[model samples]
Target: MNFNQFKEKYQKFEVEEFPNKVTYSPLVSVLVQTYNHENYIRECLDSILYQKTDFDFEILLGEDYSTDTTREICKDYAEKNPENIRLFLHHPDNKIIINGVSTGNFNAFYNFYKAQGKYIAFCEGDDRWRDPFKLQKHINSFKTNFRLVMNYHSYITVDHNSNLFQTYQMKLQPIGNISGTQLLEGKFHPLLSTTCFKKVFNEIPLEMTQVMNVDTFLISLLGNFGDAIYLKNIFPSAYRIHKGGMWSLKEKKQKYLSKILTFTKLEEFYLSQGNKRLSQFYRDKKANTFKMAAVFYFLNLNFFQFIQNVWNYIKTKFFNLKFL
Candidate 1:
């Protein structure tokens, strides 16, 4: 996608006045993007709606067309909570839901531009916050520390059934400053739902749309604005792992393939930003995916794929060629 064209098209992604009549600035904007998450979307929305905060916050439910009842559910929530929920639906009668449409740019494009708050919090349909005070606490931290423009906390890992499997324990006190690299490779980078950052943005960076998993660069981009903090005092969010989720792949080779795609995009992204040093870091990271993919393919006796990945790895690692 031409980012220049994207900028021109959506630079003025007009924040139309809410039909429910909202004038006062909200304290936070909760972004929830979903597709066929009928089982979990309610819990996710409830978790945010139940949050105890003195200030008002709006939920931007970017309802990507879902074949199931996801859009209906979002429509219901928006109607019931007209003052709180804003439904951005891709279809009128779920045609887009059945057939599907290009969601890469618009799903996140609207989420970023349509926000009307000082802070932004993310909660996908499958993720939920453990603490009702999550927003209040993060807002307090931001208010207290002028330097901290970004804040993220820990989260627990849960199965699809909401069964807790492991805890991401971060025992240290709140950190005052964190770097972009540290945020990417740190012990607790945080799930999207676990972060509450100030809504300070100039333009939508090209990287957000170019990659599938924008997790690595999102915090880094936010970190560019100001130092970030990782909180350990509060309750962590619950990140559910299941078959439907994008990140969870049953096969080892598939996992490596996904990682390879993300890391390669990251390398290209870093290169686009003119950070050759970090670009090289992602380049090295991409090698592991290639190596792992090669091993998996060879063991599975997929000779062609194995040889292909091996050649890919050699070119990337030794030749230092930019994939983009």
Candidate 2:
């Protein structure tokens, strides 16, 4: 369809047949947002299709107009498995305007907002669950808990040739007890795809979506209501690490600087947004974020590293450097 036609469709999507029929389904909604993930979409969808949950669930594939054949494959899958898959396919015109730059995150929100299930889970096109019980585990937690958010750890940050570089896990001890103060002080969110929780955001500010860290706003809202559970299971959906991935940008020096400055400013904003003081946990969390930003700043900067070495030598000469 043409761009204008898609725009008209999106404007009316809320009152369409799917919206009206959503309340009839009594189960979780798995929201999958796709751009051009032709290579990985099958494996991703296969994982979801095999979920061992007793309850019913639907897959909402929010597709952006992909330049590749990804949309065709999704269409084929939906047509073949009409019961399990429902495509809220985006028309080309439904593009999001981010600082006038339209990208896939626009479609992410569109699909996310049109969710009809009582609970929601996220799975990006490039990622897939490693375990069959991924959905069932989260669904059980959600059925028993009234908390606004729940997430599990995923295997990310792999080595060359696609192997685990390091096993990663977040501090999940205080799972069901996270407070806004804890979040402000630095309780963090796990991977987006690894999370599944109740639909808690009813009044998200429009501006929050435009910022690069929309997930932060989402988790913040959840943390505001109740504690988010951390499933601690290491074998969650795999977040592929490749050249096309966000963290794999070749312009590390420039990207690092920009992200660091943005996050530092965000940290400050988080502290002051509601006239709030961060909890000790969150304070340490923000501090760690800053430290990561500092390391990332000089990660690929030869000159910056040289200058830093020189500075360290000078400080050592004066016996002024302290590792406190």
Candidate 3:
């Protein structure tokens, strides 16, 4: 559904809007989802606010009832920069639970629904954009190619102590586009924090709401619309690796389980979409992940879990069984 329809259906939650001073509509909406990110929220907001873009962009900050001072900080930023920031305070009860794990899906969905831009960019509260012209560069690429539905750049990883860990540069030469088929075949996967895509939420699948890794599903879904561009030369954004970070700090088993669930649902989703090849791709990925999980369990001396995962892998790979 469109933004208006989405808002009409889930308008029960309250939102605090800090109106922009500019009369022109925003060309890009930067979505920032945060929870207990008090330490990094300031830098995140500042990085976006510092962007040197000619076109107007609005920051849609979704603060998910942070237990720390994150909410206060977000409110302060919204009030001070009314022209750029629109903070949405979320309640704890509104969080979406997947497999008994609470997620920021509700917060993210609300921000997306309220976004008033042709293109939507994403950067979590813990990550910060390093390039001053990041948005301008991506917008330029989109404007030059009408078929491009998504664009992403390289990024650097920083450790919890704020030291540089690694740099992930795109290997594509001369900065070219990759088709949706390539994306589905695992030729390229973009970092969510470095991605900017066209706003087309009219056909968001029901499986998207059921999965925990919404970002991965979203990138895959965007590929269905058009090709994606890779920026090879832009200054890399910073992806923080902190102890409290969502994906960074997860245990290996937990990460494996999440991936398995995501792949299972994606396989079913593609099958329902009438893409048997893509469905099988995810099915194979799910089996591989299950095998890896079994190995991990064996290495950890968890015989029971190891046997369970091995059985699951056998069923998935040999019998074409589904987990969901």
Candidate 4:
């Protein structure tokens, strides 16, 4: 669909007309999702609270009932910055557990319903926004490029284990547009902390709620509507790599399997949406995932698992595997 068609489809959500003098609503809504991030949540909140934007914005945080003092810390900040920070929507200490898996994203979904901004930005509890003018920059970029539905920048990676740090960007080239195909195939994605997107869609898709990489799914879904922007070298946020981090903490085998499953779901989604090109890319991604997982198992001397993967690979290669 063209830009006009996209606007007609998704941008029909009732919103206050943009005032010529900039006085209607907060230009953005900052979303912070936390779970046992007691050590780092304060920094995340501070980064947003101290941002030097002229426009008003709300800090919408959801603490998934940390076993530690994460919720209490957020409470303190809410009390201190009542005007800017909305009351934290938190889960109980005993979070929802379905079939032994944690299902505590209710607060995240809740934030979407409660958000009242033209644009929404994301920063996990463990990540911090480094640039105070991040929001301002994004707002300006959107103003200049009305075709862009999403704008994101590179980020800094802090490795707690190695005590090393470095800036990360998708490509060595200068800032440019990110294709919907790339986002759909899981080829590249902007870090959640560094992303800001227009609130064009009416509601989250049911398929999206079932994915592990919520941020990736969202950007790809948005990509379906319009193009996205990427800032090459500019660092707007810091993504900490720690032992307890969500996806980073998972075992290599588990992580690979998760990616395999996610890609399968994504492929199915794209096919259902009549996106054959992206769906084919997802098939390739899933095949590569299986190959990588097989290699890992072989390296670990897990012969049985390795053989199982080999058969799966052969099935996918020659005989159309129906793993899903």
Candidate 5:
């Protein structure tokens, strides 16, 4: 649907009625962090604004000095809808190069800290929900259990062009508990945008170390504190796939391969963070990662030039898998 259709459908959503109480659930703070998603930001913000939940909610839109008209569009929305929209413009005091690094974890941490809600939720600029009751579904789940993270599956990979693939439940653990080791073993949640958390976000310590892939580290910390519930009903948010996405397995094969190396290095440094069995599992997977990297690297390498390095590494380390 077009932007007008989306907005009209959103405005048509039925609002749920609520009973008066002395105290109420913490306002649901939805953080809509955008960098340069001028194409789909409206759909994202509209989805949140159109939620049929009875609980009060606010949006913290952290627009990171987008060069495109993303800032203008967001500002326009905030102006007419002043009560629910909180716009944070990321204007640097000292001029700096505007790389894709503007929407770092610090941006999320800072906005989340400023949120005056009891519960927190997130939606990316390039994604939107299909169901108007998405927030209400998660909020109702919290009433039954005050867990750290309340998650639901999403039908990702659909976009303006086509759907390359569909992910039903992107999270590694769907039925039971998930461990940090499972995350390292190539098992992980699809995107941080798939889940929402309690307003207990401030308790998380944000520092220099949390500059990248901070959501993984943050999820681990949250898992330590409480359980993460997963809803299984079939509604899913649309995740637009393009060059702008942080991690696209199809678009960034080389980058993804390098991440395997990073994961292995992290596993070694934080070895004590998980059990020995899980560490060993990742160690085995690390071997496969290296082998795949070698295969891809060798395919593009000069004949017999990098062959020596590849052969020596495989012979010296992965002797057992050599027969393959």
Candidate 6:
């Protein structure tokens, strides 16, 4: 289905939109997906609002019925900065559930549908951009190179107290352009907060709703359109690791399970699309991830789990070998 068809199918589950006062078309749409992020939402909004750009942009804030004051805070920001922020109040019933788990896919997908800019940038409610010129820098790269579909920069990992813990760059030396296959092979992993991409596709694949990490799926999907540029000069964004963080707060076992599931679904998705190479690649990755999980269990001295994961790894490896 095309984007218009996708909107037609899912638009009825629409969130309440608070219109912004921006008259001209925005060059970029900043997608901010928030849920129970009252503590960090202000800093996240402020970071985007503080960006110094010659061109206009709009913030597509998807507040997914937070039990905390996140929704109220987002409302206040929308009312105050009517020209820059368009707030969408989402319903809990509209959330996408996979394997009995509710996900932010619905909120994120709705924001993508409503995005009206040439480019869409992502910064979750818990993450903040460190550079005021981030948008300007990304837009400049996009304008200069039409073949570039995505761009990302380095980022700093912050603890719950917002103190910097570690800084991450994609590589030791910058590569000008990275292909889609390279992205899928785990050559570079772009954090959602530090990434921006061209608005190329109207319809998202149905398999996307089944995954745990939408950001990873999205980066790989966009790479199919064009090359991704890595910016070395820009100041890194901040990715907060808090108790409330979705991925950060998960247990090691849970994180490994999520990755295993993600890889399995991605493999299936590529197979359905008739991309045998990518399907086989993900199959190999899935088996390797299982091996890693087994190693983790062994080192943690969880003998039962270690044995189970090792058995799973053996099964997956043998399955792949049969296919080969």
Report, for every candidate in turn, its global Cα lDDT versus the true structure. 0.71, 0.60, 0.81, 0.69, 0.59, 0.81
Model 5: per-residue Cα lDDT over 90-193, one tens digit each: 65321121223333443465466657787777888878877788888877777887543545455566655535464443434354444534433435554667
Superposed model 2: Cα runs more than 4 Å off: 1-23, 97-102, 156-180, 184-186, 243-250, 253-324
TM-score of each: 0.80, 0.68, 0.88, 0.80, 0.67, 0.86
* Model 4 Cα lDDT, one tens digit per residue, 16-120: 211122223677888887888888888889988888887888877777667889878988887777667765545353333322356544556556656778999
> Per-candidate RMSD vs. true structure?
5.0, 8.1, 3.4, 7.2, 10.9, 3.7
Higher-scoring candidate on TM-score, 2 or 6: 6
Top-down TM-score ranking: 3, 6, 4, 1, 2, 5
Off by over 4 Å in 4: 1-24, 92-104, 159-175, 232-235, 243-250
List runs of model 3 lying over 4 Å from the truth: 1-24, 167-177, 243-250
Over 4 Å off, model 6: 1-14, 167-177, 243-250, 300-304, 320-324
Model 3 agreement with the true structure over 13-73: per-residue lDDT tens digits: 6666545463348999999999998989998999999999888999999998888999899
Specify the poorest-scoring 10-residue window by lDDT in model 4.
14-23
- Residue-by-residue lDDT tens digits, candidate 1, 226-262: 7687777768788877534333324565556556766
Point out the higher-scoring one by lDDT: 4 or 5: 4
Best by TM-score: 3
Residue 50 in model 5: shift from native, Å? 0.7
Model 3 misses residue 320 by how many Å?
4.2
Query: Across residues 1-324, which tens digit of lDDT does each residue of candidate 6 receive?
Result: 556665565545666988679646999999999999999999999999999999999999999999999999999999999999989998887777765678888789888978899899999999889999999999998888888888888887787679866433324433456886776655566777777888888778877766787776777787688888889878988888743433332367767877877778778888999989888787878888889988987877888988877877787777554221
Write the number of the candidate with greater lDDT, choosing between 2 and 4.
Answer: 4
Residue pairs in clash, model 6: none
Cα lDDT tens digits for candidate 2, 1-324: 233443454443432122222334747889888878898888889989888888888888877768999988988878777777777666666565543456565576666665667778888887778888887787777667665355555445433344655433323323344555454333565667777777766444443444555665566556665666667653645776553434543455344333333343444455555534432223334344445544554564655654654454344334433321
Residue pairs of candidate 4 with colliding backbone atoms? none
> What alpha-carbon RMSD in Å does predicted model 1 have with respect to the real structure?
5.0
